[model samples]
Target: MSDATSLLTVLVTSPRLPAGLMSRDAWTALEAAERVLASDLEDPLPAAIEVSGITVTALPYDSPAEAARALVDATRSGSVLWVGSPDADPGLTDALAEELTRLDEPPQIEVLVGSWDLPGARLLDAVAVMDALRSPGGCPWDAEQTHESLAKYLLEEAHETVEAIETGDTEHVAEELGDVLLQVLFHARIAADEDPGFDIDDVAGALVEKLIRRHPHVFGDGDASTPDEVERSWEQIKATEKADRDEDDLLAGIPVSLSPLLIAEKVLTRAARRDIQLTYDDKADLGTRLLALVAEARAAGTSADAALRAVLRQIARPATD
Candidate 1:
C-alpha cells in the first residue's frame, strides 16, 4: 500500500441485517485493504466477504490486547481492515487505542459503520422476546396467557396510554404505548403458536392494505382537499368494504364493546353521515340524557369519556390540608 492508503479500518455492520448488505464505502475499503482480518472466519460477515471473493484472514489471538497488537503491526506495513464482531468485539477498540498511543508513528485508525439498523428494527427484538417468553421452559406466567385471558390487560394498557398522553409526559406516554404494543405482540405470539395461518405479519399486512385502500387521496388519484372531505371519503370506502353486511342499518359495524360515550358518539356520527335526523323527547330517560351529553361533547370536539375520567380522577385525589 502507498503512504496515503496505509491505514487501520474498523468495519462494523448491523447484526440484524444480512451480512453482505453493506455501504459502498465499506466495500471500497475492503477492496483497497492489503489484509482483511476477523477473529472468527465462520462469522456471518466474514463468511459473506469470503463468498464475494475477498480473502478474510482469521486472527488466532486468544485475547483482545494480542489482537490489537497484531492489527497495529499489520497497519504499520499496509492498509488493514478488521471486521467487527456481532457482539461488538468487547474491549478490542480500547485495547487498540492504548496500543496506538505507545507507538511513535501509528497508522491512521478510523471506525466505519458498514451497515446500520433501519427504522422499526427494534420491533424484531420485541417479537423475539415475546416468542421466548411464551416458549416452553421460558416464563411460566407468560406461557399460561391466552388471548381471552389477556383481553382485559389490552384494554387496561390502552386506557393507561390515553391517561399518559393526557398528562403530556412524552416519556410516560412512550412507556404506556410500549405496554399496549406488548399486548399486541403477546396476542400475536399466542396465535402464531396455536393458529397456523395467523400471526403479527397477517395483522400488520391487513392494516397496511386497509390504510392504502381507505386513503384514496394519498395513495390513489382520488381528490380530497380538506379533512372533512378525507373523513367522508374514508366512510364511503368503509361502507363499500362492508357491502356484504346489512347496508340499511347506519350503525351496523360500530363496535358494541366500546364505552357508552364512544358508542353514542359513533352512532351520532353515523346518523349524521347518513343524513338521518334522530331526536329525543323532552321527557327522555337518564340513558337518553347521558347520550345527549355525549353528543354535546362530540359537537364541541371533546371526548365525554375523557371528561368523565378527568372529573373522577379529581375526586379520587387525596385532599390537601
Candidate 2:
C-alpha cells in the first residue's frame, strides 16, 4: 500500500490551552494509540509526564523527542492523547523537551480517543517522503522518465480522475487526482532536469497565467452568462491568443488515427454544421433500422460499427467513390 493511505495525521485539540497538561483519560488514550504507531525513538524528552494509568516516558536523554516518540508509538497502538489539564506534574512538561524527529511509521501513537484525530500525514514531510522517488539517489526507473514518455500516463490518470468524479467517489477521486499530480510533478522534474528553467512552480504559474488571460469574462470586463457562452468566449480568446498554424482545411483538426466509428461521427458532425440532418423520430423506424443493421452485419460477418463505417465512408467522399 502507498504510504498516503497508511500514514495518518491525528490532531487532538484540547478545549484548554497547551499548558503542558492532559487529562487522565486523555493520557490513557494516548497510551492506547501508541500500540498502533511506528516510533523512531531517537531523542530525550523535555518532561516526564506521569499518570496513574498512563506513563509519559522519562526525559533528558540523547534527543528531545524521545518522550514524544514513545507517545507517538503508544498512540498508534490506541493510546489516548489528552488535551485538557494533564494529571501528570508540570515538571514533566519542561522535562519532556524531546526532539520530535520524524518517523515514517510509529509503533505507537498516543491519541485522545474522543479528542481530535491525530492524522498520519504529518509524520513525514513531502520532500522527505518523495526524496526516495525523485532523488538522484532514488529509484532509477522514476529518475529516467521524461515528459514525452510520461504524457500517456498523465492522460490516463486524468481520465481516471474524471471517472472518479463522475462516479461521485470524492476520496477515490482525490487519490486519482493525486496520481495525476504525481505524473505532472514527475514530468516537471524531468523538464527541470532537461532544462533548468522549467520546474513544477513554473508549470503551475504558466497555466494560471493562461487561465487568467483567456477568461476575460471571469477575470476581466467581458460579459458571458451561461457555461456555454463562457466556453464560446474562452475559445474566442484562445484563438485570438494563439498564433496561426498550418492547416489544409478546418477538417484537418481531426487526427486520422481515430477509430473509424469516431472518425465517422466526427465527419458526419461536421456535415451537420453545414445544414445536413439525420433524424429518426419514429420509435418503430428506430427499432426496425437497428434490427436490420444487426441482421445485415450477421450476414456480412462484420460488426455493426464496421457496416456503419462503410456507409459513412461512401457518403463522406461521394465524388471519390
Candidate 3:
C-alpha cells in the first residue's frame, strides 16, 4: 500500500475558457492544486486560472524528457501537479509514467480529467460512430454503401436542405444540414476502405487548401475590394489551377451529369466569357429557344436551374381550401 504523502495526483484539464465553461469538479481541482503546470507559457489557461487567485507555473521544458524530469522533481514535495491539456503533448505523460516506474518509491500517479469537452466537440464522436458502423462486423446496410450507391441519397438530402432553408424553419434546416453532412461522412468512410483510401481529414484538408488558394485576396497578395472583384479573382485563380485540364475548351470542366438548365447556363456563361456570341434564328428548334432563355436568365443575374425549380415547386403545391 502506498502512503498518501508519497502519491501525486495530476489533474488534466482542457484549456478552453469562459470560466463558466469549466466543470465544478475542474474548478475544485484548480482551487486545490498546490502547483499548476502548462507546456505553453503564453497560453490563456494560466491567466484564466490566476483570475481566481490560483497561481499557475509554466513548465520550463522544450521536450518530453525534460518535461517528465521537471514533473517528477515537482511531485517529490508531495504537491499535486495540474497538467493543462496533456493531449497537446501525449508523449510527455508516457515519459512521465516510464520515469516514475524506474524509481523504487515511485509516487502513486493518478490521472483526473478536470474539464469536459464542449458541445461542438462531439462532432468527433459522430466520425467515430460512422467508422464503427462501416467497420467489419458492423451494420449490414452501412457496410454495403458505396459512393455510387449513396449518390441518390446525397442529392435527396441536398434538396431537402434547400427546402428546409426556403421554408425558414431553423430546426428543420439544422436537421436537413445534418443529413447532408452524414452523406459527406458516409462517402468519406466508404473511400477509407480502398487500398489508397483517404479519410475525412483529407477531404477537409483539400477543401481548406482550395478555399485558401481561391481566396487570394484573403490569404495571398491579391487585391479585391468589391464582391465582383473577388468573384473575378476566384475565377482567374480557378482557371489557372485547371490550366492543364482541357484548357483549350472553356466548358471542358463543366460536369455532364448537371441538370439540362444548369448545363445550358454553364455553356452560355463559358461562351460569353470567351466573347463568343450565341444567337437562335426563327427556324431554331425548341431546345435552342430553351438555351436562349437560360442565357437571358444568366444575363439577368438569376440561376436558370433555381428559377425553374421555384416555378416547379409553385406548380406542385397542394391545393388549399
Candidate 4:
C-alpha cells in the first residue's frame, strides 16, 4: 500500500450546529472525501452534509470491529474515510485503531476538532432546565414553588456545600455546589414569572456589578496590599451600599432568620470588632451562660455555631442509626 492509500481522517464536531454553522475546513474535508461514513444514518448531520452535495454513507456494520474492518478495506483503495462526529461515538475510534494496527499498511489517522463549546455555556443550560421545570405544563412541585417556599432549600444547600468542602471530597463538593447553583437558578426562574420580574441575567449582572464594586484593588485604582485591608475595604463598600436603608442600630441588619447560635456568635463578633464590651450577670440563667460561652468561643477564635452543630450532629447520629 502506498502513502496516499494509507490515510484516514476523523472529523470530530459538535452535533448541535446547522448546515452553515460548520467550519470551512470541515466543509472542505466533507466535500473532498471519497467515502464519508457515519454510525447513525438517522442523525441530521449526515443529511445536512448531503444537502451540501456530499454523499455520506452510513456504515452497515453493527459492531465497532465490523465498522473498523469496513473502514480499513475502504482506505486500502487510497480513499479518504470521512468519519462524521466521532467524538459523539465513543469506543469506535479505539476499535478502528485495533483493526488498523492489525494490517501491515495502516492509515495515518487525523483527529479534527471542527467546533468547541464556549466557557460557562453549561450554566445557560442549567438556567434553561430550571425555566422548563417552572414553565406551564411542567413539574407541578417546581411550578408551585416561590421564593418564600424555596428559602429553606437555599439555606440547606449552603450548609451542605460547606459540609462537603469540610469533608475535602471534590466530587461531593461539586455536587453540593451544583445544588446551591440550582437554588439560585430556581429562584431566578420564579422571579421571572412575577410582575416587573428579572431573570438569571439580572441576577448575574447584579453579582458582577457587586464584585467589581467591592474589588476596587483589582478592578480600580484602590491599593489593598493585605487580606485584612481587602476585608476592611469590602466592609466599607458594603456599608456604603446599604447606607440608604434606615438601619440606626449597628446589629439591625443582622439576620433574625439565622439559627440562635449563629445570631449569638455574629452579634458577639460584631460587638468585639466595634469595641463594645458585653457584660453578663453572674446570677443569670442558662441562656446567659450560653451567651457567655459564645463570647468565650469568639475570643478563642472558634465558631460557636459550628461547635453547637458538632454536638447536635453527635446527638442526632444515634437516633438516626
Candidate 5:
C-alpha cells in the first residue's frame, strides 16, 4: 500500500480514545509518525482539543465498535494500529484481551503494561532504576551506597512504617510502606548488582514463599479459628521449619542485639511459659512485689527500671573487689 493509504488505515485501526484524554506523548508520537491523520484527529477531539498542536486525525465514534469499524474502513494494508494503554479499564481491558485472543493477524510489537500487583511490580521497577542510577550513568549518591551504608536507612524506614501503622494514618502508612519498599528494592538491587544472583524478584519470591510456608493453617488444610489456635499453628510450623534446619529451642532464636530490658521481658516470657512460680503470687501478690521493687528503687534514690537494671548489672558482672 502507498504511505498515505497505509497511514489512513493506521488511524482507522487505532482505538478510538476518550476525547481530549490522550497523553501528550502518545499524540506527539502519532503526529511524528503520521502528521496528517494526527492533525485531523486533533481538530475535533473534545477533551484533548488543545492537542490540535498534536496534529492527529480524530475518530468520531461514540462507541468502540464504531471506532474498530473506522479502522477497517481507513486501512487497506500494513500500518501502525496504535492501541491506547490496554490496561486502563478493567472491563474494557478484559474485552480487548478476549478480542486479541480471537484476532487472525494480531498486531505485532503490541506491548502490555501495568498489573494488579502494583506494589510488587513497582519494587521490581525500583530495583532496575536503582541499578541504572548506580551504574556508569547512575546517580553519585546511589553509586556510593554500600550495603553497610544503607543499613541504617533500611532499619529507619521499617520503623517509620511501624510508626505509621501505630498512628493509624492510612495515607502515612501507604507512603511509609513505600519507603520500606524502597529500602528493600535498593538492597535487592545492590545484591543483584554485586552478586548477579539476587534481585528484587528473588527477594519478593522468597517472602511470598516464606509467608505461604508459615501460614499452613491459612493456605493449607489446617484451619485455625482463634488467635491462640493461630499462634499454636504458627509455633508448630515454626518448630517444624527450625527442625528442618536442625535448630532447636524457640528461645534460642531471639537475637543477641535485643536490648537488656527487652531481653529480660522476653526471658521472663519464656520462663512464664514453663508455668513456674517466678512471680510468687496472684495479681494482688504481683502488685505487692512490684510495689516492693518500687520502694527498694525509691530507697536507692532511683527509678524502678533503673534500679533494677543497676542491680542486674552489678550481679551480671560482679567486680573483682
Candidate 6:
C-alpha cells in the first residue's frame, strides 16, 4: 500500500484570460509537483503546460469518481498537480471529497488559483455577444438595427434608468443601467459595421481621454478641492478644448430636444460658468418662472428635473379608492 500523507494540488485558472498566463505561486506549485494529471489532453491549459516541458498525464476514466480515485492514488507516490477544466472541473471536487472520506488517511488537497479575471474582463463577453447578434447568422432584429432605428431606445433606456433610480430599487436601477449600456454597445457595434474604422474601443478611448483631460485634480497637478471647484475646472478645460468654436454661444452644444426644464438648467449652468448673470422677473410668465425655479434649484444644489419627476411619480401612484 502507498503512503496516504501525500499532497494533491488542484490548480484553477480563469477561462476569461490566456491559458499560460499563471501567477508565480501557481507556476511554483506546477514545477514542484512530482506528477501532473489532467482529464482532457485537448484543454488549452494542459497544452500550455506541456509547452513548458512538464509531462502531463491525461486520465482515462469513465466518471468524476473514477478520476478522483485515480488522482488520489497518484498522490500516494509523491506530490501531484491536477489541471482543472475550464468549466471548473464540475463534480470533481465533491467526488474527491467523498473518495477521501473512505480512506483511512487521505492525501492533503490544496487548491491553487492559477489566474484571475481582471476588472472589466466580463465586458469582453458582452462585446462578443453583441458581435454575434449583429453577425450574419445571428439575431434578425439585431442585424437589421441601425443607429437611427435604435435612437428612440437610447432615450427610453435613459428615462427608464432615471425612473428606476427615483423608485429606489437598486436591482431595477442596475437592470435599467444595463439597458442603457446595451444601447451604447449596440450603437458602437452599428458604427463599426457602417463606419468600418470606429468601434467600441474608439468610444471607450475617447471617453477615457476626455475624463483624464477634464479632471485635472485627479489626473494632473491642477487644484480643485470642492465639488464646485471641480465643476468650474472641468468647464474651463472643456472651454479651452472647444476654443475654436463660437465663444459667445455658451449654450451651443446643449441639445434643443431636451425638456424645457432640462434646457433651462443647462442654459443657467453655462451662463453661470461664463459669469453671465441671467435676470428674471419675479412676476413673469409660467415658462420664465419655471426657468427661475430651475435656477433656484441649481443654487440649492438640487436637480429641478429630478424634483419634478419625483412629484409626478407620487401623483401618478395607484388610487387607494
Q: Candidate 3: deviation at residue 293, Å?
A: 1.3
Model 4, 1-321: lDDT tens per residue? 646546777877764444346678877777777788877666777777777678888776677778777877777666665556534666678998888778776777787766656677578678778878998888999999999999999999999997777657899999999999999999999889889899899999999999999999999999998986887788778879998755345566778777787788877755655678889886899999889988888888887888777787678775553
TM-score of each: 0.88, 0.45, 0.62, 0.72, 0.50, 0.88
What are the lDDT scores of the predictions, listed in order?
A: 0.89, 0.50, 0.76, 0.78, 0.54, 0.89
Q: By lDDT, highest first, what's the ranking?
A: 6, 1, 4, 3, 5, 2
> How do the candidates rank by TM-score, highest first?
6, 1, 4, 3, 5, 2
Cα-based lDDT at residue 310, candidate 4: 70
Task: Mark the 10 consecutive residues where model 5 has the least summed lDDT.
Answer: 8-17
Model 6 over residues 1-321: C-alpha lDDT tens digits?
Answer: 556558999999998898899999998999999999988878999999999988899986778899898999898899999999887877898999999899888889999999999999988888989999999999999999988999999999999998898889999999999899899999999889873657999999999999999988999998899998999898788879988778688667778878778888888888887789888898989888888899999999898999998898779985587
Model 1 weakest lDDT span, ten residues long? 1-10
Per-residue lDDT tens digits of candidate 5, residues 1-321? 233434321222212333544445544445554323321333334224334554334544444454444454344444444333222322433444454456554433233221134243444456666778878877889878878999889878876786577557899999998888778777777787674468777877888998998777778888888876776677667777777553324346776764444445554444434444353333566656664455444446555555555577679878895
> lDDT: which is higher, 3 or 6?
6
Output the lDDT of residue 181, model 5. 76
After superposition, the stretches of candidate 3 with alpha carbons farther than 4 Å from their true spots are: 1-120, 280-283
Q: By the TM-score metric, which is better: model 2 or model 4?
A: 4
Return the number of clashes found in candidate 6. 0
Off by over 4 Å in 5: 1-82, 85-121, 244-251, 259-277, 280-321
Q: Which of the predicted structures, 2 or 5, would earn the higher lDDT when compared with the native?
A: 5
In model 1, the Cα lDDT at residue 209 comes to: 99
Q: Model 2 off-target regions past 4 Å? A: 1-132, 246-321
lDDT by residue (tens digit), candidate 2, 169-254: 89999799878867766776676666355776688789999989878878999888887677667656655665473222435457
